[model samples]
Target chain A: MDSQVTRREVLKKGLIGAAGLTVLPSVIAACSTSSATTAPTAAAATQAPAATPTPNANILTGKLTLGNNHSDASDLKGVNAINDAFKALTTLAVTTNTVDHNTFQDQINNYLGATPDDVFFWFSGYRMRFFADKGLATAIDDTWAKVSSNFTAGFANAVVGNDKKVYGIPVDYYPWCVFYRKTLFADKKYTIPATWDDLITLCKKMQTDGLTPIAFSDKDGWPAMGTFDILNLRMNGYDFHVGLMTGAQKWTDPKVTAVFQKWATLIPFYTHGYAGLTWQQACDTLVRKTAGLFFLGLFMTGEVATVDATASADIDFFPFPFMGNSFDAEQALDAPIDIAMISAKSPNLAADLVNAKAYMEFWAKGSTQLLMYQANNGFIPTASDADTTKFDVLTQKAVQIVSKAQKITQFLDRDTRPDFAGANAMQSFLLNFLNAPTQDLAKLQASIQAFWDALPVYAGN
Target chain B: MSVTVMAGQRTAHNVARRRLSRGALYVFLTVLALIFLWPLLYAAYTSLRPYGEVVANPNGFFSTPATLNLNNYFFVWNGGNYPQFYLNTALITIPAVILTLWISSMVAFTISRFNWGFNMLVLMIFTAGNLLPPQVIIVPLYRLYNLIPVPAPLSDNGLMYDQIIGLILIHTTFQTGFCSFVLSNYMKTLSKELVEAAMIDGAGVFTIYARVIMPLVRPALAALGTLLFVWIYNDFFWSVMLFKSGDKRPITAALNNLQGTFFTDPTVVAAGSLMAAIPTIVLYLILQRYFISGLTLGSAKG
Candidate 1:
């Protein structure tokens, strides 16, 4: 009987706890209502300033929301610093919502289609235009009109929609190039290859010297696309490459087959078991002085610097060797630009338009870009006036390379529809080629074309 | 005397054979345990080393204690918003688990105790809900969440979308099907005599449910609670899909914050993953006995 009474008391306490647990959401929800109540007053501030040409003249004061995808520790700090600068200059209170970088990229379509923040981070090139064409993003042409003189023609074209309206502010970009340790090159007395034949001879020499001629890895699937992009740009031209990505050109074009046939010849010189190694592991060979050359982005310096802080000083890169084609002089390369844009679907877009435009205009400044560049040097500023004197040797050279280019393309994924360029599609298709480089090029091209043809047509909103 | 000697020799030979077999079994179990523990051991080892050390000597299988440090943990802990994420996860998980257990147990009592015309069909329907993949209905569900207008205290947004309450509802609704099926079968094993005795003693249905059946199924409830807590706590997909604010996300979502788009510190990521797993590990340890019994409970007759 004593045990039974004790059990009853225990049961009574459990019931009370269960009831209390069920009521917790309401308490949380109630607490959050304080912030929620402020949203309406901010939204009600939408006045007769939608027609104003001068964003600064309005002195807009209200709450604006921003969605950021730079979730990395240093990157998040950079974003916060930029926001702090913006808040200091303007009366608008910015609410920045940060999501995981990859998650943000994966769910962008769903996010933009639903309720989106007033302003958000994005990539330039086809993706920026793709969303603008779908009417998911606001046209910041007025903001661009004021700041166009601050940027270059390449950046100006990058943010333009199919309808020729400017949609975003191009903030920063990093280029893909062949990186090598300058000390190794100096020790071996190796000259930077200027032509395809010279590159082959250098690889042969590196092989005889008992070094992996090219440190390569395709485990991430996207790294292989870098090789393909540079090869295509060298063999064909910028127009042809962009046409292929946009489906205006066929994959089975003899020119496309030629690029793969050329890549197959250099496959033997890649690091052994590259399919099982990540880009970082491949980058390690360069760091350890076991490899002759590494072909990757400017961001490779960031990876190497983490291991050896002084290593980046020894790192240098040359553009991929000329393939003796007419497009060689075009100096085309993949320098994907990161942009920031305002979302059209934001509920407070009307009220937030003035402040959002101010935020967009603020990003257009070279000084603003310099702030972010200092925070994370992996991304070089696109604005021409961003103090070049502040750059490290590699960044200075990278800027010169980008500015000299007659044509520029975004990375493959950023240049095409996400579904076609996603992990299941182009990533695997590229992996399939690398697994067996000697496979029939014609059949591979046909399969690539078939995959593109079968995709549902992307209908704009 | 010769016959007795032969019997003694046979017993000694049998003992030798049993000893050899036991040794082999022990060897097999040791290898299996090592294979299962390899990934966890590797992560823990990697988490202790500095990022540069791991990068320089990725294949280093053996290292001195001097090389191993908690810098990676400190780096991730200092960098990430772990405390807020933990609070967010707790808010979503505890309530969802309790609600799911309470609702399912009542449904189990009703279905198992009384003889109703639709009892078997109801159980089958509940079981079948578990078979439908959550992905199939996500698009429509997203639209539905946006369309639904909720009160202020229930949802700060004044809508079901992007609210913590929305996550709790979805978790409870989806998990109830599996919990109800398991609890009903367990409730069936309880003798009807107890219910009949309670009814005879002027006990109402609610009284019998609260006083009699709940106490009996405490073990199963504890097991289910542990499982549900972990599932809801570690949920990445629903929270990612439903919540818009970064600070509103749970701990599982916080792991992604350690990984960068262009650059990542693998040691920091490994440390973050282990840190995120601590709560679930602690809960499993506490309820392990009930969990083990819960698994085997339905296999044997009561």
Candidate 2:
């Protein structure tokens, strides 16, 4: 009787109640309103077991709102095409918002309400863990399986939740590779280097030839993070990248130390004014033909377009030439972008989510892909055979490299273990610190390693 | 002939002096205007060009006139979820200004006129409230807001927890401390002759303040209102703390999203920034004449 009374007390206290009452009203209101507006379709509700099985009949409906990351109005086709298609498929509204990834959570908190919009585009890895733990996500596993095989996945087996549920989907995926000005390389009369020695020699030749070997920006500490991540991929290979992110390997390990060493040696090869330069500014070094190399992804193609659209073909991107190609170049490191998801506490939970799914699926394919490529001068996320006519020679090269890669590495932001991801910002900090000859490289190394030690260890299934 | 030539030389000399003073004034004003308009000028120039151009030519001020690319504005509006942001900002700023003014003026009138025994203590408490960091209140407030349930049958679409109204309430409450302090100080200058006359006429405290003293504080009110308007717009810490949707975002929150994304389109960003700036610039233009007068009035009265 005492236990029973305790349970009742807890319920009354709303500690663990019938539902989160703050969000309950919106849920109830949306349900009643949805019921009144549209008859529930006879589609089978996905009753897949939490393990592995196909889900049926869970058609996410209503307006699926996604946060637009890094895209402006001109990049509409990528985000809104799916929104349009979702509208065509259902009598529901879907929308998207463009937002900054840096302050995304802080920005979202300002709008927290019971009836939070049905869907939002946020991050994965540690950020996603924070949301998932807080119960912000709708755990769209059942919805995922229904459309799982429809579009191919980079890492189909590894993307599932602990209970074997899939949490997010892929939008655009790529390996953060060395994007070089092809014309500069050709003009310099240099062949593509086969090994690390060849790369160093090329950098020296470029330096001697009065050209910058690489372009980097440490202003936000991100361009350096790219430098660090790429070096880590080279030093430790893809497994170590996964291990370090999951807290399986200490960040201060000799292997990790080697990664930092690589960045330190390469710093001299970077642009002269990199300390205060933004990535966009640094990218201009390549676009305007001042610098020839940048270690970034196809995403940067968007920012450098005004330099000269044709010189984009002067660019050639290649994944870090692995000393050990355990896998084919196509099977090497590729980063997959996190997909759109429905919120558990959304206003019009059922209808809104179904509508949102349709839009996201459309975003993962078609003209959106082409617009993304043409606008950025990067590779589109499509099969190799998807019309090579529109692509310039530069983007076509990127397309050929991406198509044959069997396994794409997930983004460091997403693939890193959840706890460590929160502290991953420190990696960029240490790398920037390493660039200065005055700073103690040892201290920088320890500071980042300390944060790595502090992260919680969670075992992934 | 000599007298005529001398007269003509003297007239020409006078004209040159007058023209020189006018030229000096124009030069000075032009310099001052450039100083004042530099930020907007930079933002405008930056917005017109594509990111590549700016990167290649960071110091280029006027070599080209790039069209004020509407790409960023429309992108922000449609793709960035700026519509919800505008709505949320309105919700937070409007109520915060109105209610704080009303509450502060009332508190000020009572404190200034009523000879309450602990009035000084009350004033001191309110004055000291500004010393604490707002972050101290955040955790408690979050829990408190979470615990306080919304009434039943609440609209699903309406924001109860993190909407603009909630932000308005927090800001309104926080601002009252300073508003009351300023109002009370301003009210002290209310001529003793008027108060004495009112008291002799058997006018109640409320009636005296409402009829006599309130009208006198119009300039003070205007000064306070403008300050409040700028504060709400420039705010970053709380707006992010309170509101989550991109649609409900303010200019500050939205501006932050510009450079960090994978997309490095600087042209779109510059355009969006210019768009965000337009209203504030227009507001100042509308209110500048009265604004300075209000400030001068408060300082002189004090």
Candidate 3:
């Protein structure tokens, strides 16, 4: 009887304990609400300027939020310095939210869907258009109208959506070409090839010299796309390359197969075990003088600079050699533009618009572009009026190549829907082809076509 | 005398065999120890090397002359927001470990000591909660956290989405299931006579649990506490998804920011990882004895 009573008492206590545990969260919630009520008011006070109308204000004067993806230490420092300069020019206080670069790009959909900042860093081309078409990005035509004279027609077209309104402001661009060390070429008595046959001959010569001709890496799965894009641009015209990227031309078309066949011919000259190496590691090979040539963007200079500061001066690139076909002339090349856009879901749209436009106009100025270019010479300024006097020898040569080109194309990933490009479809497809170049082209084409066909049709305005 | 001599010879032979086997065991353990320590030594060695040297000799560590320096450590420490990350991790981990222990212990005590009709059913529910993968409920939990409005003191951003408190609450709630299962089985192995005797001595239920039950479960609590600390400290997924602001992220999540977009030096990454691993190693060392005892406590039920 005593044991039974003890058991009952224990059961009663357990019920009370469980009830207390259940009530604990609610208590915390209630306590948190009381303490947290002041924060929103504080936030609103900071955002108070947005509530008032500024009908005729020319210069934006308020707080502006910017989401930046320049997560590299050097790049972040440079960007922050630019923001500080912007703040000094206008009375607008800028709050910068810096996220990792890859994370920012991968999670952009969710980031934009939620309450995004007033302005966010992004890439130009179909990437900018896709967001603008979905109404996630605000039309920056009003800002573009002010800065129209500052940029070239090519840059302006890159930011314009299908709806005929600008969505982003292009800041900088870099061309992709065959980069080689000037010293290495000078030592080996190798001349820059001007045609497909000359390029192949040069590769064989380099091989006989006991040097890897091309330093290639596809571990990150996007560097190989550079080689593919250049080959396609050289083999087919820019129009067909763009068509293939946008899914307007079939992947199984003979034109596409021809591009792969051309790539396979040069595979023997590439660095062995490239599939496991990163682009930086590949660039290291070039820096260490083990490789002859590397087809990459001007950003390769960043890696070279780390090894030898003066080696950047010894770096020079020529546009991928002409293929001697129907489209024989080197009229096209890859020149991807980096851009910044205003988010449609910004909390204070009016204030955000004024601040974001001011920022765009600031970047449009040659003086502002000069500041950025001077800080990091990885890419050239987009502004035509930017001071070219301060450009390095490499930058000057890049300008020459870009100016000679009749048409410039964005890279494959930037030209297509991000879902298709990033969902391991194209990356893996290219890797599979690189691993076995002699595989049936028909089967490869079919797999790519099937993958593209299975995608849900994107509905956009 | 001859019989005694024969016995002495047999004893000496046995001693020789025992000594030989002990020597073999030592050799085996030494090899095992080296295998475990090899990666750590490599990481430490690589962290001390310059980025240029690391890149130049990717295939082997000893190919180049070892110029051990603290530059990588200095760069990682002074260059990044590691101090803030450490604070964030500690703030989340300490509370999470304590709450999980307290709540799990209370539940285990209730289930083990009580005679309620639904005791076994309740215990089953707690165990079953841990059976499901965390990924299965991540989306729902993400939405729920976003929807929940936390106070400013508890959350700087006024939402549960990017708050340390939210991480603590989630950790405590999700981990309680596993802790309660382990603690309850451990409690069952204890003698119930003491609890019955305490009740006869005019003690209440709380006194019996607090005085009689908890003191006996100290080893288990220490073991669970150490394990929970490491698990909560190393959590990457929830910290990344829940925190909107980079500043709000814990150490493990913040480690991703150490890598630059285009140029990441592996030496700096190695140094950062070694720094991040120090706390868990210290905790394990401190709790070594109790951890071992607690793990083997229920293994043999003789």
Candidate 4:
């Protein structure tokens, strides 16, 4: 009986131990699997440059981590192609950690606060400035010096902080404009409006023809900001708009009120149930010929192409019609520029900075931007010297519009404090305005101002 | 003869009343079933259709029969890296469920079977921990995870930030509370005489807990184990927050990665969701008998 009890005790201990033992190897194996997969890519990075050495080969070496938000398959392909090009040109081994695009943007503060990648994708304007001021991002002034000739002064200015330090390398930009179907315009004999009065007349004509004049959606809460930004820029001019965004100018000012009042005039012509629909759904209304026009970024082509591949050919856009105000040059447009920046919290800061600067320098090259543009034509290349000869008709038109502009503003969200913009302050205000346009503009403006005041003032700002 | 005829007519009336009520019940049940099944049916139907067709007819479910194909499943399986995500999920789920069950059961066994100082307080602590919202702890937990360093063999990044073990630990820690609570209560309902009998028979604490008490609480364990598996498997927030690497993310979190930045194909998303649902569905089905009984077992006592 004693022997039997001992055996039973031993068996129980063995079972308990086995449960613990089973998990360890699996954990190790899982880690090994991830490391093994990355090992091949690192190996490939070193081996490829050996096959065909270019002029700038071996300029930078060692593994550089890149936090990429290019979650789209097509965009990922383009980014990968560019990275491969960079690896081939300069022997830097870049290991990319891709995250969901929207999530990446939302969690960027936390990601940067932690051990972030050596280099990461970001946008320019106040958003870049905010991070740069926080010392979260490394200044790429050395990189800028090498590629200064490739970009315009405007592009360079977008990347500079308030402290006069370059923080990011602008890669591509897309303009927010009034997108319309060319074929539908042709069928209806509708002429592209050149001014605010012409636009109102066109809207009236569209309404008479039994169509929604504007395909508007604010379901995602940021699309309507595009409309508000364009209106504010048109009505208040660039300086006031920028001042208002930076909280230097009061939201309750008459200038802001006028912008809202002007926006109210077009509410009758917007798509019914606009709040229920997403931007893609609004774009669908245009694609299906149910709506006359959509005011969105150049990415609208992506939605149109998804439904009918050939329909993209019929898609064209014009600048939001000049509002016939003091700032009626159509100069101030929303042209959000995507930029790449090196993180200050990089694990191997010195070595990673070398690789990151080299990568940014390569990105700033016109030839490199041209290669990227060739891979994905969603946005215009930022480099002034980028090859535009091969640009599609729509892209060329976008370039022409941007080139002629005296001022370009990033979108409303990108221009202001993220806390104010991201926390439904502007979005809800715009949504409320959309819901009841004629309701107290003063109250709306006051609320917006109050919310802005409530934010913890950034010391750097 | 008149009385007999009246009696027969009353019987016929009663039969008709019963049949009418039964018909109503059937109708109600059918409606309820359809209400529950419609979303699954829609997902399945949408996953079979081409993306363009679905986009064109977003409101309609049964349009464009010609566009229906298995292409989306193929795309989700091959293009979405779903197999890798599934493996990641399994790696996190299995160990988490086992550890949670083992640890929580031990706690439950000790608290229920023995009278010790601060036993109720310990149980209260575990139970109260489960009540706090996950978001409240996210920031502190995120910082903590980043600070803790593990060996290279345990984490490719050599930190807890993107480790599967980190995910498992969080899942186990968070889930153990509810599991132990339910389990302790369930074990309390079991007759103390059985444990007393074991103690009198010279059985050790481990022997009593493992051999005598454990077998009695199989139903509760099975139920909690199933619940833990489903919850951890379907977890998206912790997985995404804890792991930055796409390679380490579970299937639920990986679904977000399948979405294109500019254009997400709806059919592909539907297909991916359906694929992710399969493992949990299979698990629930296999554990169905024990699950229902186990859930009701505690309530049955009171």
User: Model 2 fnat?
Assistant: 0.37
Cα lDDT tens digits, model 2, A348-374, are 555445455555555544455555655
Q: Which lDDT tens digits does candidate 1 get at residues A201-261?
A: 9999999999999999988888999999999999999999999999999999999989898
The candidate 4 chain A region of ten consecutive residues with least summed lDDT is A40-49
Clashing pairs in 4: none
What DockQ does each listed candidate score?
0.31, 0.16, 0.18, 0.24
Query: Can you tell me which runs of candidate 3 are displaced by over 4 Å?
Result: A1-42, A51-62, A326-330, A346-351, B1-3, B57-62, B189-216, B294-302
TM-scores of the first chain across all predictions? 0.89, 0.74, 0.88, 0.89
> What is each predicted model's overall lDDT from 0 to 1?
0.84, 0.62, 0.81, 0.84
Worst 10 residues of 3 chain B by lDDT: B293-302
Looking at model 2 chain B, report the run of 10 residues with the lowest lDDT sum.
B151-160
Q: lDDT score of model 3?
A: 0.81
Candidate 4 residue runs with Cα over 4 Å from true position: A1-56, B1-13, B57-66, B189-203, B300-302
Q: For candidate 2, give the lDDT of residue B120.
A: 90
Q: Tell me the lDDT of model 3 at A52.
A: 40
Per-residue CA lDDT of model 2 for B125-236, tens digit only, reads: 9879867789999767765654454442431233345455567777788888888888888898887789889889999877888899889888778878877876776678
Give per-model TM-scores.
Answer: 0.90, 0.76, 0.89, 0.90
- For model 3, state the Cα shift of residue A154 in Å: 1.8
Candidate 3 lDDT over A309-414, as tens digits, reads: 6777788889888988877554788899999889997655555566677787787877777777877887588888888999988899898888788788889899
Per-residue alpha-carbon lDDT of candidate 4 for residues A356-452, written as tens digits (9 for 90 to 100): 7778888887778777677778857999888889899999999999888888999999999888887468888889889999998899889988988
In model 3, how large is the Cα lDDT of residue A414?
A: 92
* C-alpha RMSD over true interface residues, model 4: 7.4
